[model samples]
Target: MSTQTQTETFVLHNRASPEPVVHEPAQEPEPELSPKWRYPKVLSAGMSFFVAGVNDGSLGSLIPYVIRSYGIGTDMVAVIAKRYGTTFAGWLVAALSNSTICQYLDLGPILAVGAALQILAHVLRTWMPPFGLYVVTFFLASLGQAYNDTHANTFVSSLRGAHRWLGFIHAMYMAGCLVSPFVATAVASANQDSQWALFYLFPLGLGVANLALLGVSFWDRMALAPKRRRHVAGMSGGVAAESSGKSALMEITVTLRTPGVWLLSLFFFFFLGATITAGGWMVEYLVNIRNGNVKDMGYVPAGFYGGGFLGRLILAEPTHRLGERRMIFIYAMLCVGLQLVFWLVPNIITEAVAVSLLGFFSGPFFATGISVGSKIFAPELRSSAIAFVFVLGQIGGSIFPALTGIIASRVGVQVLQPMLVGLLGAAGVSWLVLPKDAGLHRD
Candidate 1:
């Protein structure tokens, strides 16, 4: 059932050697990177996702305490929430900009910049600032994340065993999310007022670690850089000034004209929305509606992320056997059922189980879509496609979090369960329409 084939090998003999040197026939570019086991690249990328997960999960868990510390109303908290949310928005812009610049620059430098930004932003957040400063700092940090994310997705997807690698990266992120609640809570319990600041230390450390790893691993890997071609806009022979203006727009026009990019973007829109909404809302829902204890509430989100790890481990081979389309649809349907169980049931334990099941089963869908996009688009378009989809997904992430706040402010946190069901349903529909062997398409 495997779509993969063993490559043919050719033996070569040198004048100095009695034995032949065998070289395997180079295969079509893999959907993942060469030497996928290159430990450093994997480690760096995993830490990146991990930092993201921890940041997201801890911030959500810390929201109540932050509101209390600032002596602000829930409305003021929402305004502060924009600071965190703007990071994602800035990520979108960075992705687009990186895609254009990747033509002329190495992805490593871009990622390094992002890591530095995260360290600076987190440091600023820990120092206690005005709401506007908080938002601006995160936005700047998020721009860096966008660069790292798009390049990382592109780089990782170009390797072998993509599903497993993607899963590992995402699982690390979940692991970060899983750990954050406990860390944040333990800190918060001690200080009571300024606990959120303590959580920044972890990402600050990770950001530094990632910078070192990236410098060593990819410092000289620019051969893998996206190819750049110069376009001339003169009409046979024209004043250079007249042609310069038009060529600038042409760069953006080329990316916008690709159909495959737009569809992939739509895919990311739904997928990221589902992920962020679930991660951001689940703990709050449990604590608020189920009257779950804050000390115990840490486990609920961990369970969700734990489920993600399992999904990644179990589904990698099966997805290859069954194909991406069928597997995605199956998981999507399963998520819907799980969400219903979380919603209709009133028991906290049962809700926790359902939420975890939902998180575990659903994590692969987002990572898989990225793999699919890698296969479906041309290499020239791959990062841009990734950027397009990722941006849409973040837009979804932004909208759902803000919406959940509104809903929680009005009807209650329990609304998240039912609303989540609808979102998962939409994701399944999107998967159904996704092209088969999507990664194979030349366009």
Candidate 2:
């Protein structure tokens, strides 16, 4: 009956029981919830495209300001420098995405990394780095855009009603382009000559919002930890890991060898060359060649982008229903005719109208090309194939504008019209040569 004896008896009783009373540990604090859009995945993806549009659209308007700030006569050389950087970064992403790296990651983290790069680019621009260093920002921004937009393109292409969605996203891009010029022009026009660099602050804010949305919308898929592979009855873990790497390489090699990929890439090589050249140089072309008022002409590029926005919105379903192939050919011809008008006309108002009409005709070309690409390649090959085409497109985007600038510095900016005309012709031809049945609805 001693206290020690009683305690010992109680312990014995507890130990002897079939199940002892159990106490749970205190629950850990839940992590803070992230901010997110209430909209679904498709809309989130569209927002990313809109961000890209804003980045791209604003450039044409900003070129005059950039030229003035840097005391450069022609901005084309700077554009080439920027594009060369972008082209290199784009190819780097294409190579890595095709390599074993993608096996361990998903699209979301890739997008986040891209967004971060863009943010850094804007931050650099906001400070107005020396001209040599300033051009480097384009490369950073282009590389980031390639990563983020390529994956977003791939994702949206797989969903139902892909053509409509493709139109929707590209339209968002044009919409961004339309809005950016007005803002950029307004800000630059208001600021002192030394303060032109401050315009980058607007995009810097947007880039931050872009990264936040990408993080939230893609949270579930964002860099999910790679699962450990269960060992086969006789296989070693090292061998399995090695085989995984090899498989990734094989997938990329197979994608590279696809004929459709090469043909599609060739088409975009010309297509994007035309698109970027027109948008990037329009303001300069108008001011210098058309006797346009510098203040008023800065808004001309918006008309081009606005036309594109309307074209994508109005023409998406028609393109799908009328047949993508036939419709594109018609669009190309119309674009050629519009360019001729823009080129031959001496009046600025006439030139502006012609440019907008050209944009309207040219707008569906990109989204439609992607739609066709989605159908031509196998699902597994789609991402790599599209990435390859996009990289080539960036090369064209860089090369032609640089070429235009170089030639313009010699013969004058008047050379842009003829160069664009030739590109449009080549693009039409490239599209005609692609395998006609690759996009068969069945498989």
TM-score per candidate? 0.83, 0.85
**lDDT of each residue in 1-443, candidate 2, tens digit only:** 00000111111222222111111011211132232322355676777778788888887788777777777866445354435555456556655554455555566777787789889988998877898777778777877887777777776665445677778888888888898988888887884564667878887888898889888777765753232122323658687678767767887788789998889788788888888889888888888877787779889999999999888888877777776677788888888888988889888888889989888888888888887776676655666777787886777777888788877888888899999999988887888877777233221
Write candidate 1's Cα lDDT for 1-443 as tens digits. Answer: 00111001000111122111111012222233334436677778777777766776776677666667777654444433633367666866775575446544566666677778877888887766776786677687777677777777666665445556666776777787778877877777776345567667777787788778878776654333333212233334354333433432454566677776677666566666676677766767778878888667755777887787677656655665566677778888998998888888899989888878887778677677776765665554566666766676677677766676676777887777766887888878876666554333211
Best by TM-score: 2
Count of backbone clashes, every candidate in sequence: 10, 0
In model 1, the Cα lDDT at residue 261 comes to 67
Residue 194, candidate 2: C-alpha displacement in angstroms: 4.9
Model 1: what TM-score? 0.83
Q: After superposition, how far is residue 323 of candidate 2 from its true place, in Å?
A: 0.2
Q: Worst lDDT window (10 residues) for model 1?
A: 1-10
Q: Candidate 2 overall Cα lDDT vs. reference?
A: 0.71
